[model samples]
Target: MARQPVARQTVARQVVASPVLVGRDEFLALAGRRLEDAATGRGHLLFVAGEAGIGKTRLVTSISRRAERLEFAVLRAAAFPGDAEATGGVLLDLAGDLRRAADAGWRDVGHALSARLRDPLAAQGDPHRQRRLLVQDLADLLCDLDPGRLLLVVLEDLHWADQLSLEVIGRVAVRLPGRATLMIGAYRSDELFPRTAMRQVRGRLLSQRVAEEIRLPRLTAAQTATLAGAVLGRRPTGSEVAAIHGRSDGIPLHVEELLAASGVPDTLADAVLVRARALDPGVRDIAAAAAVIGRSFDFDLLTAVAQDAPETVDRCLRELQSVYLVQAGADAATFDFRHALIRDALYADIALPRRRQLHERVARVAVERGYRDEFVSAHFDEAHLPGPAYWHALLAAREAAAASSHREALPLYRRAVRNLPDGSSPDFHATLLAALGAEAAAVDENAAAAEAYEEA
Candidate 1:
């Protein structure tokens, strides 16, 4: 399930009204032309990708207003967390928009869409078969919005859409038949990680030329200053622009928030926190545990450290993925946060005692899996388990030296020396010093090599 949408709004209320669109003249013009083409029976799917707060919504809104002015029936909906047929009900929502329009063709199209999508239990057979039937039903209804008539369907926050919704939407995008309907979706570009469902679909669309996506980058420094000036109703001073630009990192939403509050507003983490807190308790707890493992983690390690069944962890992770908090990584077995900011926020939100416990668990699991000694050593050290920490430090140093990474080995060797467990044998200490001396010499630090030899 996707997260609950804020509230459904009419197309006019949802996107007809937007503030100035900065840094998008060329795309806006291109979209204007696309609208003309769409109205004339050549229609296609379009997409917008950007980081959160980078003005994706604003860009879509600008296009939606133009689409409306050209007599295109504008319909807007967002994918959110909940049962698709219950809370979100995006298909039904669109149907409602159609009914409100009350045109003969549109009203019939709306009724057909509602009949197929509004019920989760009625006439339920094979889920796969039902989904196929729904796709066919949706495709058949497209002509009602085509040829002499047109519709612009704007779907936002697609990064939060569930798998079933994604599949249905993709099929709809593909089967439009170059008629008079344009389907445009907005998703966080950061959500497009390797092997993730969204990434796979996006890649397929682009590769097959089934859709065209516009990626919106952060505002340039000059553009950021311009935006600040507009919000301020006067030109911002050099220092004011610099401060806002630096802190906002050129994300338009951050810029708007900074200008609105005239300060940093305490923490942008608030938004992350609010979303995290709204998650199911079990999922939220797992997210915190994942954070303890850092911004990037694999499914196996997370499952082991999370102490849950693999299927359970996968379910929770899917929920996390749908919300754009964590994304699938280079392969299906790996995952990472959409941004370091998200990971840092979750990590900081964990209590210190719980954090230590998770670190200890992570170290234990890593050791069982024979993970890199440096990784194991860091976690053990964080858990304050000096005995194990010292042991892995020595192992890490030896491994680094074997890999011919003497510079990295030096610190590992020093860490081992500093954290040596009590009651160590004299010969053991001497051997450690000799190994350190060799690595130090390998790096051409003759002075340090002599000091280690003398210690030995």
Candidate 2:
């Protein structure tokens, strides 16, 4: 799940209204002009970034609505928090749009897209030319979708997007110049630091100087009060506003959660758990298992981790949805916790032994399904099953190194060594250290390389 920047803290107060999007007049004005520009055949790339719960989605929804008012044909797609690996997952959300456009005479383009994206459920093809061809076709499709009206494509939660999805969007942004289209991407800024696939996407786009980025700032105390007033239909007392701002740090989601979860629990996790406990114990158990599995989890995966019958998990999910704890994903079989904070709370509240057990199940199921090496390794590490953890870590490290992400591979190799159980073969430690040393040397971290070599 996309994480909150702030440490766990209490939700502000117990109040509720449709989310009040305050203090973004300037951004909305800028967005309006960009839409007008798109209508005039001047395309744009707008990057909206902020920390979790800072109203990134609310702001973009506002932009989309404004664009609609201007008669622009808008298409929206969002990447699942931790499960965006399906091929063209974001673009595939527009399958309905593509079909409709086909019926309206874009048949050849639609056929081309269908052929290229024949198996949207599978991983994308690896060849550069294949990806470029698909991206080019998609871009042309966008321009032709509604030749007279401007087209607005909004990709949300990009920090969770797969590399192929990011690459496709980046390519579209570049090709949209002088076309009647606007591309907007929203991602968590806090998650894009130092090293991440999303950072690489941003780097390429920024280098081209083709996109304008707007980083949403935390709300000011005054703005917080306005937001609170709008939600409650009455201005807050001065003390209440101060409390909200202090606890929430002016992040809209935090403020909203705090307001809705009044009674002032000491931490956000506490508030979230309080709500979870209000649901059926069975439902809550399912939720905890889902969190242990991953934020964005499928029905089959949850059932496996829950060790329960499929029907049982489905019933629990229905109960959870009644409380707005989890919502069905783009695919009805998949579900996501409505908020990352809630998942954090549930996962954190699980007993250590139970967490280990659940993680072990997740690792076993992932290995059985031939899931990505990183996920398999991650669950094993969480399970603390030293032998399997160590071996999977090594595998994950090799995968990362093969991708030229040597810096990322280094820590995985270190994890392999750290998790080596007693009586392990001497060669195990030697091999792990050798891998670590190689990665460190590749990154020019000679001291690290020497240390690993000495240990080996």
Candidate 3:
């Protein structure tokens, strides 16, 4: 018995809210202009690459909207995760558009495809064969029904695309000459490492010189501030602007998250911390470790703190990169938390005991390596141990002060003052008082300097 066809919803709903169109004006202009040119028979190919959540989709959406206004036909497809659709899936998507445009019911198209491909079940074959026939049908239909209409095809998240889809795209790329066609693809460069299938497709595209690649760099400080202001509906104070820029490092997605988290009364740091606490445990841990280690961290250090097998850590890192919580470094040897705010958020998420343990390990590693005393002291301050911990921490602060890193020394001195046992020796008290005075003087805080001297 022939089964009934499952009803499928074809409505195209907008998933993104009002996006604050930050940065990337130049790139957007170039893409828009090229697409416009393509509609006039100057066909070109564009490849937009960036890290995940770096606004590739948003940019492309803007271009697509503009193209529609200019009367150009736009076709879009996105790759899926595991259970990736084969090449036929992309072809099927293209074919559906062709069928719709012809005003020919799918049934008629299916009959035509089955007759053309010489398959009895051409209308109801497995998705793969259906896709193959669909593509063939689509190409023929395009030629038959409006061959002169400009068509702009966009494939997004190509990193997740299946091998067959990539091959299909390669075939389309080779056949684009003299046709009213422009193909645009977007993918995350960090995840598309050498030797992968995606990389192979990229290599073919390059060798053909049919693709023009545009790599989006991180946002500038001014651009970040402008974006934050737009998101918040007000100008950011100097401190707030600096805080967001420092932490977010100009990633549009991070900037948006930070603004949403900041709310009306809370500062940027507080907002970042709040958001960080809400992430999944694995992401939060990786973020925290990255923050403690600074902008970039070694994988070995992360594994040491997480106490997980290498593969487990690698998996977590990849997840972090996927959501833009972290980024892999250029050489692929190090990983970085995208923004300082993310790091702070992650740091605040961990259990106190685990944080202390991680800090202790970091401190021990620094001490064993004869690293700068100040760096070691910073870890001790983080560890929050007692007795000898306090003394070693104090020594680290003094070293920092000697190195003229008064800002770094200030927290250490403050911690020592707060944690020192009561009724301590006068000499120890006097030394701390003097160190605090010196730190204040270095920062030109005369009033605080005088107060420290008075305490001494």
The model with the greatest lDDT is 2
Question: Mind giving the per-residue lDDT tens digits that candidate 2 earns over 1-456?
Answer: 211122222223333534657999999999999898989889989999999878888899899999888888777777765433244555655554455552555455455556555532233555344446655666665556656767898888888765556666777787677789998999999887554557887988888898889999999999999988887788899999988888888887677656666554556676677677665566667888999977678899888888777877887787666556677875668888876766877899999999999999999998998876657777898998888888887787775565445555776787788888898788977877888999889767799899999988
Kindly report the root-mean-square deviation of model 3 from the true structure over all alpha carbons. Answer: 22.7
lDDT of each: 0.72, 0.74, 0.64
What is the per-residue lDDT of model 3 for residues 1-456, given as tens digits with 9 covering 90 to 100?
122222222212111222478777898899887876777666777888998657887888888887888887776655533202122334444454444454454335544533442332345666446556545554554334236687788887777654545655776666666667778898888877543346778888887787778898888888887877777678889888887787777777666765655342244455555545555566556666666665557787767665666776777677566555677752356776664445656666668888887788777776766644445555676787555456765775664454344544665676677667677998889888888888778656688889988998
Candidate 3, which ten residues in sequence have the lowest lDDT sum? 9-18
Steric clash pairs (candidate 1): 2-80, 2-81, 3-80, 3-81
Q: Name the runs in model 3 displaced over 4 angstroms.
A: 1-20, 83-89, 92-146, 263-456
Model 1 CA deviation exceeding 4 Å by range: 1-19, 82-88, 119-128, 193-196, 264-456
Q: What is the RMSD, in Å, between candidate 2 and the native fold over all Cα?
A: 6.7
Residue-level error in angstroms, candidate 3, position 159: 0.9
